[model samples]
Target chain A: MPDLGLSVLLKGKNMARLLGGLWVALRISLIAVAISLPLGILLGVLMAGKNRVVKAILRVYLEFIRIMPQMVLLFLGFFGTTRAFGWNISAELAAIIVFTLWGTAEMSDLVRGAIISIPRHQYESSQALGLNKRQTYFYIILPQAARRLIPLSINLITRMIKTTSLVLMIGVVEVLKVAQQIIEANRMTSPNAAFGLYLTVFVLYFLACWPISLLARYLEKKWR
Target chain B: MAVKILAETLLSIRHIAKRFGDNTVLDDLSLDVHKGEVIVVVGPSGCGKSTLLRCINALEPIQAGEILLDGEPIKPDGKNITELRQKVGMVFQSYDLFPHLSVLDNIVLAPRKVQKRAKAEAEAEALTLLERVGLKDKAASYPRELSGGQKQRVAIVRALCMHPEMLLFDEVTAALDPEMVREVLDVILKLATQGRTMLIVTHEMQFARAIADRVIFLDGGNILENTPPEIFFTNPQTERARQFLNMFEFAAVKHHAPAED
Candidate 1:
């Protein structure tokens, strides 16, 4: 077979650095997800509410996040905010903040869609049966909405993981950043190392996201 | 069985007007339903029969008017609305059973959660109600597992488990298949015989004539005629009421005759 330059990943300390870089990406994303899940759910419910002002405010917020690019958001969080607010925010903290903001907006929309997808008759029937608002959501609405939410949210988690790659633009030194460093360091020894290093990065991403995709598929089928 | 409608009014609707945007559904409609009275409301489609029931249960907000249950006014966002709703149960055209819950859980949910009743007591009551509706064995079944008629009966049982003073049925049998309609209607007929107070909005004329203590004929967002079922069905005063009855009678005639084929 032709030489595909697959040997660079087997070199000293390079593989370990890549793994550490991946963990950095994962840590930021996992922390963001943990914060987003509950906060997003609350915001979702509020977004679905009848209050004109609250709905309008959340509408503007959701639209703003959707309209702005994630890269610009990261730049704003890391560099622009530091200049404007006169506070020193670390690159990792900035990455976490930016990802959490993006994740929350996406997650809340998912929850809002899930909540509104339920038939209006469900709410009327529950109310007629003397269930208070809180009781109705707990006993009837949430349990059903959760099924729709779980599959969609797993998909969000995967997206969040992949999107964490964007944080390297702000100098967070994540997987893609480490892969570039390795490729540069090995340029003289292995001129074809760029191909293998990039290929390894793709494999690492697939390995990280494939099982989650499988879980989402399994749940969607099982619940459906 | 002949129910004795007591002189004391259990529910009183006073000049209520309900509007959706520019369209008026119920305009200046007033009614008094006494204890143990079976008031069946018959109207052309979109004549506000279901809206009236929803307004009474506080599901729909009235643009104008007052509704009193046990001499206390009922408002959509009233402070004691939850407590008031506990005393007034409403079933819908669609069965609207909680799909995620088993029949037993659906029935006992409100009793346990709102009324703060003991779990054993709620389940026992639910089982008893289910048995009365001929659904004793279906207590563990989810809404999707049961037939439409079975689901509607469970919806009724769910409402009854709350021990509401009055029940509202908004075309509860409308969604069932022809054969399944009887089973659901039979349950309502049994409730009427047992002297349960009810306000029923239905198109089942024969059943309405059989069960209603009084019949209210509605049209154009108003009650055109409020009379006993005997008078209302046989000799409706207005030309509008006559035309409405003729349409049903005409259909009934087609129903009994041999198939054209």
Candidate 2:
């Protein structure tokens, strides 16, 4: 039989620390997403542009960012920048920067797909109506594309929330970091504390992400 | 009836040539459309009938030649293109109604956005046009909910809301069912009675004969014949036109002949 004591989480200051860590994680992810989404949409629109040289440059950037792992990127921003450029950066800042870069690239690709998926006739009809390029995009294309982009972008947000766990490697005192600390502190007193704390973290993450996934489903059905 | 040449020419296509990579679609084609003239262009598929219409609307850029609208040369890409496009409206074969917008919104989009008309004014005008087409009840319905003929009627009303000087119809009834084609054709006939200047590209030989002031037969990227419909149908000048008419006659016979014993 395993020790099922809830005392570790209920102890003074422990719950507060865990909640504080969760707040950090949430802040970092939300800030990253807020910074990334508009930039990503712009990049995505540019990706569909006709200029070859601009497209080539954006292609290289997108591929390089996408091909590299998030953990590797986090390390590069945190340790590599400090060593190479002699810059001092906080772990939370580094995590936010890395995630912003990653999120922008992913969101841009989604936007590109959504824009391209619009029927050719839509563009032709708009042009024939004498609508300028700006009017066409704002009135016709973007409205149609938004219906496709919302759900996929919501999925990206959830993924970003889950991926924030890797921020612990950079020494960000996030939810995962706090959970590890609690387990380590109670390792001798309660042999099963690791499992309990980890289960609690898992539940917290599920609670955070469940509503977003449900929103994605609801939007998809509504749009359809 | 004789070919009607009223007033001055409103649109002039002079020595226009268009090519798609290696395929030459329009080979130095030149024609003049008189004011209030209902010009019907007929040819076999891939003969550039639709391309000619697209060129007039500046949808396809010409390789070499100038298009003059009302004595002013039209540029393919320029600040003036939008203003020129306001005078030239096009209704496509697929109807091309915006699926995201309701019928009323679809008809009012250009007037509200491009013409900068107030929303209430545009909606009022749209409602009048909708009533004209007998689609007033479908004003709030989506394109997907309407039948094909209804959608095409809304498309015509959408183009008409611009009050264009010239309307281009590219095989407008080609996508409709046999029963549905007549209703769409009837709408075009009504437009003709109202003296709307139109350039229609269609396969409906009977409809062409009924409304066309002049007919132009295109063959192999060139206008082989331009004459009155009665002449072209009864006495084609070129072998190609005669052959084309014979095929139509044969198809018509096969269509209406008694069942084989």
Candidate 3:
């Protein structure tokens, strides 16, 4: 049996490096979420509007994003854009841009579904109450839509955090990359360093995501 | 009892035509509702009673028509439609209460937001209205916590909060349980007694007779008879009216008669 002790993680500067890597992942995820949420919600509300042209345009964009793989999108944002446009973009920025695009597409669909699922009578009743279109959306529709949206959006955020591991391919030194580096450095000293470090990484991700999952469940129950 | 134009007309719907695709729901329908009068529109299902109320409140746009409120002709697509809507309150068959908000918030939302009334003033008026409907204690409770009857009552109070010149009720009690129906109808009856101008579409024949100053019997998208409740119920002019009343009479007898051994 290989030595599976957490010595590699406890070694000099490894812990801090891993934490720093996690911070990078978390930062990208948070930035993506912050950027995507409002824009996605706007897109969603507009998608629900009666404008045929706008709906058609949004539908094409939404379908393209949904059908294309996230990895492919990341590659396009990172390598393709730089080569095609001759613009020098950083790895972190590329990750942020790709993730924001993906997240916005996903979240807008969620918002659209939630908004559409609201019964027709709710709109009619608000109109009957003498509320203008703007007032109706802000006061009545959005408040109800938020209940359905909050939990789903939180779930998407956690997924984005996990998916940020893919950024290592694009040369972003996130948690997974840090783990690989640590394992490589300790290969001669500790035979089971890879196992120990990977386990630690797993635990870190679980720790980061468990609370979010629990919160989602709690919101679902509360709203129900 | 002949039709009586007892007071000055508050709403006039002329040449209104509503169509959903190939189906014509209302065909050249015209109606005059007097101030301080309670008009109940009754007919068979698909007879356009509800559609007529919706047209008056501008919930459903008419293809060709002029709706005049207090001598002002209402343009359905005009910029002033929102302002016009403020004067016309509507209660739907489904209570349609905002599920996320408390009962008090539901009642005070329009007054505070649309009407720009002071929050305190809206709350005070809402509390009084709730108390009148015996739902004051339920002010802080969400709509999901309320019974069907309670929800409908809150819906009414929400409309009243706007202090509308005219109120439209479209089968407000149609979705309630049998026992819960009375509580909602009683609220409408109380409003009628207070002399609020109202146009109600209902399937409750007995309640219509009790509260309506005039009853409009619609058939196949046309007004078959428009007369006082006493006359319309006792001596309907058209065969369709007589047939409709016979069905109601049959249902009443069946409902009240003793069960067979």
Q: Among these predicted structures, which one has the highest DockQ?
A: 3
Provide DockQ values for all models, in the order shown.
0.68, 0.65, 0.75
Task: Give the higher-DockQ candidate: 1 or 2.
Answer: 1
- Runs in model 2 with CA error above 4 Å? A1-5, A217-224, B1-5, B251-261
Against the reference, the lDDT scores of all candidates come to 0.90, 0.90, 0.90
Instruction: Predict model 3's lDDT versus the native.
Output: 0.90
Per-residue lDDT of model 3, residues A72-153, tens digit only: 9888999999999997999999999999988999999999999998898888888878788899999889988989898889
Fraction of the true interface contacts (Cα pairs closer than 8 Å across chains) found in each model:
0.86, 0.59, 0.84
Regions of model 1 farther than 4 Å from truth: A214-224, B1-7, B251-261
lDDT of 3 by residue, B1-261 (tens): 899756898999898889999899999989898899999899888888888888887877888878899888666566888788888989988899999889999999889888899999999999999999999999999999999999999999999999999999989999999999999999999999899999999989999999999999998899989999999999999999998888777865767543322
Residue B62 lDDT in candidate 2: 88
Please give the ranking of all candidate structures by lDDT, highest first, separated by commas: 1, 2, 3
lDDT of 2 by residue, B83-192 (tens): 88888999999999998899998989999899999999899999998888899999999999999999999999999998899999999999999999999999999999
Query: What pairs collide in candidate 3?
Result: none
TM-score of each: 0.91, 0.94, 0.94
